[model samples]
Target: MENQWLQVSYADLLQATDGFSSANLIGVGSFGSVYKGILECFETVVAVKVLNLLQQGAFKSLAAEWEALRNIRHRNLVKILTVCSSINFNGNDFKALVFEYMPNGSLEKWLHPNVDEQPQLRNLNLTQRLNIAIDVASASSSSFENTNHDLKPGNVLLDDDMVAHVGDFGLARFLSEAAESCSQNQTSTFGIKGSIGYIPPEYGMGGKASKYGDVYSYGILLLKMITGKRPTNDMFKDNQSLHHFAKSAFPEQVMEIIDPRLLQENAEAFLDSENHNNLKNKMRDCLVALVRVGVSCSAESPGERMEMREIAMEMHAVRDLYLEVGIQ
Candidate 1:
């Protein structure tokens, strides 16, 4: 039952996961399959992760994940209920992580959403969207701000309540104060992690990971939440990334890229020049701020970026102002 991290019995994991059957499988993951399970403790519904150890080096990464999850917790960070280790068949070196189940899956699934649950989009008003972004920003400010490391969307999971919890520590790192002080270093990669497209260009070039990288990634998520476009959408298909493409346009072509779902309420003059007459038109200022924030965070120069805490403050200011004026 317990260790540095809570220990989960293999049998319970197997039973709860129905022997890892397809019926119980919730989704295929990059590293393993996630199954819906119930923990013996409180009959807690949890995500049973059966990690794949195909590569010899992957075991080390798995161990790192275990250690990282055990050492930290945050409302936005996924809670690890328990883990199962060791095995009988194939060396029975089985390893698994049991986390609180998030019925809504992830923001990625929600952004593009699905036909069966299209109505759910209605629940995400401007206030709710801003709140979601704030939650993520706060979590990032807490987690990565300490380690000066960033996580990608795959690492961000949303519970049924639409509350975002930062998860997936496989790429997280603990930077010594000494290490954090160095602004520009080549081997500066914080374990060389971050999802592609979401990865800061400097990180890809083997530079350091910082709170700014997380801020940069959050900005992308903001764009996705607003436009319902993946970082790899067709708009970005011809090698023009959204950040780069949006640089020159700002509030001008903003409507061209906003999510159609969000445009429904403003149908009368969503494109009307008179639309600028409304206070929400000032949202252009927010979008402009957003573009600057994204560009800075993803800046090839890490020195140019704002820290995550600053980002959270900026969002709070923007969202507060938006709500004050009742912008539709």
Candidate 2:
């Protein structure tokens, strides 16, 4: 899509925004503030992502944003409808991106299960999780998915429809001749590059992100969904990570505690089988499948990866098992 500089004058934006009042603020991000805006053209509702001007190099974020979304196609990836600029402080000129509003906010907000959200929507179900995974998997394998480096969770977006769409391509690169392209999961002692809780230990080992890295992060997200926990320096202080803890227990019942909204029937299985040991075995197998995918993709030894296409196929198989046996 050709980039359309915003049609409304920057002056008009100031008037409509009441001098950029905090009330208009939607979310604060690494770049800048996001505001809900109504355009003069169609009176359309949109999300305006504004980056810090004082930070100066914000243009790279814009280029990265553009690189991430421009030509690629996927229902799971957010779509940028237009670009706009606002004059604020001399150093911090406002650079903004307008997107179709996502009523659900973000997976981060939902995964965290905060007070601001609807009590009824406390967590995402297996189908919802799998659907999102599938969406990301599809994007991870797309031509745009081919990045020199890895993808970050911050780049992923969920619309009001609950459809997951990945955005922000600036940091993404084609799987290098040897890498899986992403990983942020790291040990508490050492932080990873992107989001803290999401990085992999291998990343702490100075390894690059790969499909496996994404897998690892996905596993963490799964654990978060199942446990309703947050990442902290002492996250595992009780000697349990959402991963190890979930793996150590029975998912059939306790897993419901992870995401208050999950029905007992939904936690029964993921990759398949009611024939495993404790919830540990069942979950171990499921996560083993997941971690295997993540590890293989992130293997410093690149030859080990199953490639994005294979990764997507494998996830589909696991999802089929969930749908066939997991519906509550």
Candidate 3:
């Protein structure tokens, strides 16, 4: 498998990306910027994530991602095609990772489409949204069981078929048996391991990275999907957070706070039903159960959060129920 990886260098990438033109620039994050390039040797489009060597933890982030993806292979996790550790034309250190291109882009765009996106591409229906939630849970269940310190929507990429793939392991850490306890979870060099709104509360209090912290972040991500709001949305000011916002409406008013677009998409289906009232009741029940899981997982205390394995299993059951009920 090692031999199968195409050996690439700064010149190869520069040529592929036409000198890393901003037109080919796709995404940017704390550690580095990602560029869409056509690797000549592979003759395929790939995402080149070039690390910012001057950044505080750039080297550590590169090492962390490599360690996280080295032995892991999951359909829902982004595939690392190859890596380049070389020097640029100016004799500066250049490090980058090549990844399979995801044409559908990030979940963040789907949740909050930019003005430039066509109106038709703005919303994800209930079924698609549920599937994405399940995909993230499955990946987090398998991967976070070890640890992926960052688990926000922006880090979730979608393939051509819209399958969610967890990526950006720049903050990932493994939780050995010796590091599963509260004190151990506090063990880390990265100051704060995740994005705001998605970060667990404990992390703000100097807590270390842990699977439980990952669960908290996943919970917030799930809630964001359901509500169609980012954790840092302007509406979430004061003591009102995405968690409390959802929790305040759980079970009863959940249907009220759901992404209006989601309601609009399903409105026609409900209206077409001869027993529209019954269908509404069933849909409400399904949504209530999902919100319950989200609230449970995002509880203020780590001990109060649900395990990722349990979340994956529960999400599976919810998807099955959604399909079985003909809710689409």
| Among all candidates shown, the one with the greatest TM-score | 3
Off by over 4 Å in 1: 1-6, 88-91, 114-123, 148-150, 172-194, 237-239, 266-276, 282-285
Position 51, candidate 2: lDDT: 68
Score each candidate by Cα lDDT.
0.65, 0.57, 0.82
Angstrom error of the Cα, residue 322, model 2: value is 2.2
* Candidates sorted by lDDT, best first: 3, 1, 2
Indicate the TM-score of model 1.
0.81
Per-residue lDDT of model 3, residues 258-286, tens digit only: 88887888788888989888878777777
Instruction: Report the lDDT tens digits of candidate 2 across residue range 244-274.
Output: 5554454344433344455443344432545
TM-score of each: 0.81, 0.70, 0.92
Task: Kindly report which residue pairs in candidate 3 clash with one another.
Answer: 186-208
What C-alpha lDDT does candidate 1 achieve relative to the native structure?
0.65
Stretches > 4 Å off in candidate 2? 1-8, 15-19, 89-92, 116-118, 148-155, 171-193, 201-216, 231-233, 237-260, 263-306, 326-328
lDDT per residue as tens, model 1, 44-68: 8889878787833345555666776
Q: In candidate 1, where is summed lDDT lowest over 10 consecutive residues?
A: 171-180
